[model samples]
Target: MATPTIKALSAVIFALSSNAMATELRIDNVKLYQPAEQMFSAPTSIYIEHGNIVKLLPSTHKQKVADHVIDAKGQFAVAGLMDLHVHLGSSGSNYTNFQYLPVEAHFNANLYLGVTDIVDLFSFDNVLTEAKQLQQTQTSPNLFYAGTLFTNPGGHGTQFGGKAYVINQDSDIEALWQQHLATNPHVTKAVIESFGGMGNTLTDTQLAELGKRSKAANLPYFVHVSTLADGKRAIKAGASALAHGINGEDIDAEFIELMLSHNVTYIPTLAVYHNHASESEHQQISHQTELLPVLHKKLQGCLFDKVPEPNVWFKTMWQKRAHAYQNIVKLHKAGVTIATGSDAGNPYTLHGIGLHNEIDALAMAGLANGEIINAATINGATTLAVDDKQGQLAQGYKANFILLNENPLQNINALHHINAVYKEGVKINREQLAERNQIIQPVGQECNANITSQTAQAVIDNFNDKNQWLTVSDSAMGGGSATELVLKDKVLTVKTSLGKPTHFGAWAGTEIRFKQPNDASNFDGVALTYKGSKAPFTLSIYHSEVQDWDHFSKMLPASEDWTTVKVPFSEFKQFGFGNKVQWSAKSITGLNFVWRSMPGTPPPVPNNEFHLKSIGYF
Candidate 1:
């Protein structure tokens, strides 16, 4: 509920002074969150030698004066927080907006929030390698990562427009795993989705094969799922963990038994669901604009859009989150290991900062403050299979913890009230971090300005011949709606009717691909012609085969007359959050036409219909 203020970013005329470090360090008379008892320990003196916690002694005991000693009372200490699910290298300002933020910004975001360790579920392998190295040389959290997200070709992973390992068949599993291992990742990530609830997932044989190969390699594998069916299927296929909890349903007895018996860890990632709720509660952003200019432009655009009334889909998502939260409590009661994963670096989920929200959400799901702390700390380390080295305060364990101004055992929100962070016996300068966050600018890459050309042979589909286009709809998941691509009289007709209420909406659509993925680098825009009845509908175009869930969209104006809609490459923003600029026209994918209501508007009328004659680049 704390709103970040402009003064948080205002320039200050103070220099950062260093915290003196020594070979031996003592933290005396501080309340400790004891993992063994799952409660705060009495005032204790923690002795550290050579970056390791060496002793937990009675504060009253007289001992050799240490090389450096902190205060003698009235502070709380807990194992530094760990976020199990995060995308450390992602800008996350938008769904498809891409930016390469400085490593320091990421470190500052987590450290400022008292998160001293993080496990990134997906990112480019090289980027993860760099982040791992940065952790040792800089004052950053202990970093762990799953090198890349492996999934079916053109599947969930492809929507992000990033480099990913595509699993076309069983053979791809070993190949992708070997390539990933070359980067020395701590875990592997895979995704299973029904194409936004409109398509199909990989065959059972394929999933089993992937799971089999992953287990054979003796590595921890995390599978991403959104529905109960997929979650159960993934577990049966031998997934080591579920990256996110299922929505829209409760965790039934079967789910509880399967996970408990299989020993599969569950990362609820409630932060993402809470983000959807926050989006529905648009008023939350009105007072935060003063902090906007300090962030990237794409982030600014996303914030601007959230200031409007809640959209129908966002409202559905907000309500659906309750179901997921309930499932988390059920799973925890069934003895399923619950790890706190923020799914950060997604919309509205800031890295490092978002983890606190996840912890808060877990508390709301009926977890005690001690249990929540354990989930955020050791539970995450256990999920990442690195509990031996990190996650707790004990002799031989890494001397990593956060000094808190208040006891988090009494109030979970106290986790955000960070006083100082000690990683491996070295202290971080909080004032210096504040200054860095205030002055840091976004490192977004600009597109090439000189690249421009017109498409001479631009026709993609004339609707005169048969082609492979698959329609997907929310009905696949439980929504009520049917859709079809009917080509008659040399025109393609897209028709739909309202179905049951669903968070994603009751609609149908398909992705149209070129003969081969066209790298339309020479072209600069797309031109399409269409006409529709008096129904509210939208047309989306995927300009390239980038894995980004982005497209150029325009409302198909309702008219008895044919209308020509041209979406210039420059006009396309990534989920309405990009700086409409330079882009590669090559690799143009397909078009998706759907009947859905826009946010802050009434639901669409029944029996929506539209027609398309031609689509091509201009």
Candidate 2:
């Protein structure tokens, strides 16, 4: 076994000193799940020491002395659940205000819902680093991540702030691969989606080269494919798993044969699709789970009143739900390995509860409870290449399991009736987790008071309120740009370094997100008091109606001295492929103040600074 990190050792020390855990513990009289038999074993006793399961014997075996003993009273014990696909940084909502939950909250939520391990398919580098560091001392679910995804420029993976490495025919594949490897990612993921020709896609050659690099590094290669052709191509190129179900067509015998031959695991992520297709306002499990009140309200509000005319992307996803569901059923019947993934950070899927919703979707697709259990357990571990140490309740494996009030094999819903959750032989305090949830609301102010007052000028952010802001740059897209935001004495300062521009150019800045839409339609424009560099800056406005990164933006003239700038709503122009529509500031979600260096421009001095005394709708 690998040596534990110092943080892990410290956690053990704290648990022992606080009497939260015993040095040697035994759980008795439990119906333990036996993965080999796909059934519950007779009454059994599990002995755990040093955070690993040491023995699993019949309950009638000679009683062994231990530091502590738990009488389970025949409760069913199964391997803690795993979510193979997740984005840890996102709060599971597309709305800007609802997307800023602290990363720890996501970890706690997963543990609260009995998910012991999660694979973040795509995440920002900072988030991945923080999560891995926190795992050592914190009681978070074990995290495995693909730091940045691979995709073409302006591809599906490039959206939502360009959290991917975009490549082209002339790009240095080896250099890009090396940079990605530097992150020490456990798995490598690439996107092969075209969104029905509405977006760019990575070429077959690009896909094959990525596969070769991943194989050479001994990393599992997972691909996001949407159509039958894309799925077959991914498997042919040495894909270890399909990140999503094929949604463009029916699964045929040929595709099944290809998947079987390649041994490529399939993660349908059916819950994301089901959530988009259904008109329901909320998932019953979400309400039962511990969610911050603000988050719960936003989630419900976003899903409650269906839009009369959904955008093309939204309509497309909704129409593909049936195809995705049918494909999962067909693939399962063909003996393809189906793993559970909630794609939780998407529109309506919440983290901890999202996995349960995925299991429920699988049941609706005709999978037996036993099959769903395997999918959520061993199958997920196999997909992540960690089967030897996780995904089972067997002796010698890590003592991570969930004790439930009833037998999950008898009824799928029994999985939700969790009596206790254990990680590395330490029992988690669910009540304390609940209390944390109550206080851990989303970090931003809502414009509820002035939302309906037509004459009231909405304050987007004053830099003095209890609102959270983020500093973002093009480094996420492989550019060298960097940015930082500091607030002090009621003033916000933005420092930026516009690195040499890539094919996509360079941008660095700061943004403030709202918890709910701010009705700025009553105002004519945005005005901000600022001072600093004479370099040009841009003010970008994000709204609910525009879902993509092409938020409407207006250029601001250079201000070498302290000055106030006012940008009219009519001056904002769409920066990308989004439809050209009249500016409607009724549901403004966020705003960004950015410095851009267009392609071919001489790299500017690395030092650039600006200050914002205040910003609001005027």
Q: Flag regions of model 1 displaced more than 4 Å.
A: 1-23, 95-100, 216-218, 279-312, 443-618
The top-ranked prediction according to lDDT is: 2
lDDT of 1 by residue, 1-618 (tens): 997566753423111112232337888888878776888877888889988988888777874457788884678888888888888766545433345566667777787677888878887656676776776777888777777777765466655556788776777777777888787777778888873565445667777776776677667779999888899998898888899888667778998899999889998887776664565464432233322322445445544443333334445657787798789888888889888888878766777767877887888788888889999888877877778978888778898888877888789878867777887888878777766766776655442213333333677778778855677666554445677778888788877776544434455655575543565556667777888756756667666433334466665567677888777777665564322323556545566777764322445666767788888777
Lowest lDDT block of 10, candidate 1: 11-20
Q: Write down the TM-score for model 1.
A: 0.68
Q: Which stretches of candidate 2 lie over 4 Å from their true place?
A: 1-23, 276-312, 447-450, 455-618
Model 2 lDDT at residue 175 = 78
Following a full C-alpha superposition, what root-mean-square deviation does model 1 have from the true structure?
14.5
